[model samples]
Target: MTATKRCIRAEDLYQIRYTSDPQLSPNGKSVAFVETMIDEQRQYRNHLVLQSLDSKDLTSLTVGAVRDTFPRWSPDGATISFVSNRSGTPQIWLIDAKGGEARQLTRCKTGVSNPIWSPDGKHIVFSSMLSPEDSFSDVEGESKKEVQKVIVVNRMKYKSDDHGYIYDKSKQIAIVNVESGEMRAISEGPYNHTVGAWSPDGEWLAITANRAENPDKQHSIDVYLVPFSGGEWKKVTKSKGTFFFPTWSPDGKKLALIGSESDTHLHAAQKRVWVYNLENDEQTCITAEWDVQVGDSTIGDVRSPGHPNPGAVWREDGKGMYFIASERGNSGIYHTTLDGQITQIVGGSRNVYGFSLHEKAQKLIMVVSDTASPGDLVEVDLDTKEEQRLTDVNHDLFAELELPAVEEIEFEAEDGWKLHGWLMKPVGYQQGQKYPMVLQIHGGPHSMYGNTYFHEFQVLAAKGYAVLYTNPRGSFGYGERFVQACCGDYGGNDYLDLMSAVKYACNHFDFVDETRLGVTGGSYGGLMTNWIVGQSNQFKAAVTDRSICNWLSFYGVSDIGYYFTAEEIMANPFNNPEKMWHHSPLRLAANIETPLLIMHGEQDHRCPIEQAEQLYIALRYHDKAPVSFIRFPGASHELSRSGDPQQRVLRLEYTADWFESYLLTAEKASV
Candidate 1:
């Protein structure tokens, strides 16, 4: 007889670990990736691991207190360079690939991150903040110290109350000589520059900079080229749209960058990739006919999956570049030529992250995911298109568990827009026996819901709840036009599309009980949950995390609020405050009848905690609904993914408990 599976709590069963950011060595003989492991103490820690191409022998390169990431190999392949905070603050560390004590390279009071090795391997380029200094007086020849202070007077529209504001330090690129240990500033200015890439000859460095005349504008980000030896910076493109993820061609004659030229919140207006010629300074749109924008384009409280943050690299021959595209489903890697002819290199239910080419072997190494697994390193044969799994980090844990099965579904929105969705039936589910259903909405209204494994979804299914998540309009993986359809029409057609997904599941799935329905999400998804509770009584319980409730207040509070509001949500916060209010879920709190469990981090700089407090207070004041508020101490906006370990488990338990009290209990009462 098959052994009875032990019941896995939402917290205990969700400790599955995986690998990410796989970096192939320069010689193509070995691969290094960030291996995330959950220890016996249940603490999540990251360490660098190496695997040989020939023997497939895996070895751990780092072990200790701090986390190590962004492993890049030197040109000689004898040493590996990475970032770590072992010395109190994040700094560059170098260690032999065979494993030994890592030597600290940079010792700055501030932190250093995003380390990229120059082509020659003699220098490492990274970005960090500059130290603050006193202002100098020319006439008096006396130094005047400017005291920087931060004050939080009230907690209203801003989400995070405990967030302490400090003096702003612009992130500048710096180069450290590997041999001399000499650190020199390569690019210095008032504007922050990040996401650096090196040219083949190491003569130039390409980076995505917000050095525009109006750096405050969220849409003003563009790519720029700077001399590797440190001098003047040159703008590559002048479009007012957001451009990032700059990848230089092998020949260094052209740059393959992802960008969008429109300000519309919809995917269509925000999705496009451009190739710029360095010689002529001419630009060409490669994805113009894809009818979809690339990257998530929503300003505030909304996200899209299509925004390719880690841009793909060009083939060694520079004939084509590999990139991930998402329109209506999960993201997949595709090869696109300069002429815009695209070919799907890896197509599956899962999302394919950026790939590293093994030029000599004609193989591609990538990170991929599906509903059953979080993410794993896989190698695909470029010519044969065959995929082979390289890592089994989570295999042992998952093999003993009974995970949910994700099935794709489609439904028509209120406006007849076709939407895609995925449904996860309860574990040990039986036909005829009704179960509670949870509707999971993805943020980035531009982000697509695909075959990727979601911990929360699996935990809900294990607890006898059927989970349903959909790719509404504005979701990626479908192509440009479909994604942009929801732009400027937040909580309108997208709301209908999500509701239709719920309706379709209830009607088609035999075990789904319509009366026992719950909804939960984080970030943009969190905003939708707030909007859903306010607009409908169909859901019995709802949980919203790191959400934006009011756009007017968010405009000044969020780091990206000013630009996101102006470009994605509103034309101008000053003139469009009413429109922002109209789209805000907080404005309709009076109509909410569903019990809400509001969750937010104390240190969330993205969507502050005040947004949660506002909804919690409003719900408590209402006699019609029950409410609960939970704050994660010392947690940031990314509490769900990168927060404290214990808190992450608690958050999941809280969500399950909220639904258990409302949805499951209500179903039992009716029975």
Candidate 2:
């Protein structure tokens, strides 16, 4: 008799380790990265970890209760600098590569982030939120005393999902003395400045900012070169499209940027790669005809929502570039020439979350993940295209956990739209037995369900349910045409495409029990769940999470409502009330026949908790369908991925119980 392996539990996610920001040392023998985990107290604890290729051993540089992240090796490779909240406020901290006590380098009043060491390694450039103290040397206590508590807001983009209110302070670029720990503001103005790559000569720092007189109204943000010695900044690109993540060439004569022409199209715009020449001030699109979007656009619920793409890196000779892009569900590294000739470097059905390149060594360090693995660091050979596992952070836990096997498949929609998706089989199965199917929809509608590890899906499959997730019309990674196909067309072909995926699965896979089917999703996916249930009663149960029910009201409550409302639906609530109501799921709430469960976060500013409340009220008031609503207290829009540990576990447990209760007759509720 064979002993049964332990199945993955919902609570097992807390023990999983997440890795990011891999930095290759100058000598390319050592790599410094960030390792984060959730503690019992429900707080994120970050540690600076180092690994050596020669010794094949791991070392923790800074480990404690506080958060430390964004480890970057200096040019000399003697010391590593990172951002930490050890002193109650986030500031730049530095420690020797040989290992010792870390010393705080910056004492910014508003806090500092995104630290980049100068080429000479004598100074570090970072972005920090500023205050009007008349001096940059004000200490913490004195700085707070100078500012008033009351905040007056007057900007259209006053609040964001990550930041509740960003009216009082704006981010400014500054430089810090490495040895003396002294800092001075470099670029301080009414607008914010985002740090990009530093020029090779250390004279100019590339920055992306909308310096237009009225930045909030315009979506145009161009890359500019700011002087390190402090002076007026010069714009390098003149484009109507929005631009970001500018990377300077090794020779500092050119810059590679990521942008698109769909500022009004919201996230539906296809991100294109462009090269900007500083000498002639000429900007040319490199990937305009490539059809594929640039940068890592794959979406996953396993990691943090706001993952920053460091942009394209110039080759050692400054003739080509290496970047990561989401293509056909896989986020992999690719190479492109100055004339737009593209080639795949490390392409496959695996997710490359973050990468760091050592130009001198011709080696790349990346954080890789897949359906079976959350994340691990790996070393990649640029010339050979060979990958060697460097760190097996989750190997122990993964070995003991029984996860379902995932298989990718392709099918055509009713309108002949070719799409790709993955189906995860049940953990343990009999030859002739059929299992209930759970169809999952992704949140961003813009974000694709790619080749990434998702703990929630694993727990559902471990409970004897087959899972089906697809990238509908609006998801990224397919191409510009496919991604922009769903703009101003929500609840239309996209809805039918989802149903087609289920139909394809039921017909193609004999193990899928179509009679016992359920559908669920969060954010835009949640909106679809509400729409799916109302539009069709084919599924026995449905769960909508952090979803938008009434678009008419969502326009006023959501953080991105003002512009996103018009960008997505093509009109504001006041201008097209009838169209907005017609698109809202609440309008068709009475037609919902399937059992519905509403889930949301109380502090979710993106979709807002009011969305769930409205849907619950509409469903409950009429008593049309058996409905339940679960609200995670103090949880934000990212509850399922990076929310409170206990809360996240509870959410998965609740989701599994909900599906089991409806899918199987003899299923017992898990507490």
Candidate 3:
């Protein structure tokens, strides 16, 4: 242990800054990125920053506590376009590359996002909300009213955790002139649209949308080409699965996209890169044979919102494309040819969450994070394979703290399936001494916990608790079979994988005290926690956040419940009532004997607060062990990740307090 270093606290989250959305200039001399920090008001303040590659000098482009993000350099590198709420709504704003006052470019009432420059830099295209009967001109003249409104529900997917009340609003593509600020909706529809990339000749814009019958009922989004002059869209992709991030090749002969070929399994389907030849109207999966999942699947709390996706970037010569993929415990940059020949460009024990490549200059700038650091921009030379750190946003905060080192663990499940995980020892550790340990499970059961910085896990380690986090069988970063193993099985083999992990850790690590064990997780992880406490009494304390207690209620309550329930569980409440009830943790609530802390977001539409309420009520009615409940008023499913800053801190504080109260004695906790 160091003399000057101290243990991290929950409030240290405010001191941790994050960097994301790195955009390389066309000239490859400087990079434009977004730096986000928590202000005194507990609100996120995101500002665009320009860093010179030659001198490593940084200059802030936008000012104040307002959010200014998604900075995209113009085709000529003379101006940068970004989205900002300075005008009270997230609208497109433009500033010169050299520096100056940023001017508002759009005044859309509903706001716009994902702005991209045209090939000639004369116009910009973005996505904005538009009702079925409203046009761009109507949106500009519209003003919101605060009076009471009537409620109408006609669709299955009517509410969303991120955006509530998806009634008649649809995300449509809109275009605006840079010089005149004249804008209008280019694609109008009842279905939502996502802007991709503009064709090299500036005649068509590629987008992803589901215009099929009953679009919301199925997970089918295909790539389509919309004319710049406005008309009917040309469907380019065969409607076989979900597709997104359509990028045009340098020569405009092909389009590189990142998506999947099957939508049945949804999250279990590995995101693959496919190239659509514009000449032949044929699509081919470039990474079909590669087992690794494409895109950044690593989960973390410090990641800034709206981090730009590093979609498939075509090489300058148009022979291959570069993209990011998750494998083992790292998200690395990879390149693949048209025939599925893949090559690893840069890989390590770190998470490359965001990236931008300058094909002509062979320069790659990526936002990389490890176990100790939040994230920073790193420049890599394609030819030389050299790397250089461009920013250190959290260096000072981390320098004064003794961050724990993470040890990767590879063990076998009870079923002989291999599993991956990481163990972080408590700060200021001493040999031959036993310490309480906390088994931290990740959400998504489909989302992987890789070599990324997690504030919650670090805080627990600082409080003298060894942290054990794992990517069980249901987690990503593994193959298709492993990821799909937990689906339809729920608390079956997935529960065994977690229990086997705890057994493996206890037997292998002598310092871990198996008697004083604690468990906590959120979302699907929360469901597992509830399931564990009901099935076993091995854990002394357990905290479940945003959990699902009853599958019957979750199917109709959650935003994506209608489809997510049928796909993941392979059963519905009406058709298979016995199966759904049999797998619900609430059904076995009477078996829980451990001290349980129930926490959930009041506005969490994903799991809904009622789920937490049901478990708490059931536990109290049965008088089984000790149970407590906490609720955040304005928080949602992302409470631990991107919820209110104050509430996020409180969630961690309550979690640690609950575990410490149950697992540690006063004398040991004081030590």
User: Number of the top candidate by lDDT?
Assistant: 3
Kindly provide the TM-score of model 3 when superposed on the true structure, using C-alpha atoms.
Answer: 0.98
lDDT of 2 by residue, 465-517 (tens): 89999999989889878887877788999999999999999999999989899
Better of 1 and 2 by TM-score: 2
Per-model clash counts, in order, read 35, 0, 0
- Answer with 2 or 3, whichever has the higher lDDT: 3
> TM-score of each candidate?
0.91, 0.96, 0.98
The residue-by-residue lDDT of candidate 3 on 1-671, one tens digit each, is 79999999999999889899999999999999999999988898999999999899999998787999899999999999999998888889999999999988998877889999999999999998766755565444466555447867777777788786677788998889999988877776678889999999999999999887787786788999999987888998877888999999889989999988886877788889999998998898878888889998889988854467869988888999889999887999999988899999989999999898987787999999999989999999988999999999988888999988789999999889999899999998888998899998888878889999999999999998999999988888988888888888999999999999999999999999999999999999999999999999999999999999899999999998878888889899888988888889999999999999999999999999999999999999999799999999988898999899999999999999998898877537668
Candidate 2 clashes: the total is 0
Q: Alpha carbon lDDT of residue 203, candidate 1?
A: 90
Q: Which stretches of candidate 1 lie over 4 Å from their true place?
A: 40-42, 131-166, 263-269, 292-310, 571-573, 667-671
The candidates, ranked best first by TM-score, are 3, 2, 1
Alpha-carbon lDDT, every model = 0.75, 0.84, 0.89
**Structure candidate 2, residue pairs in collision:** none
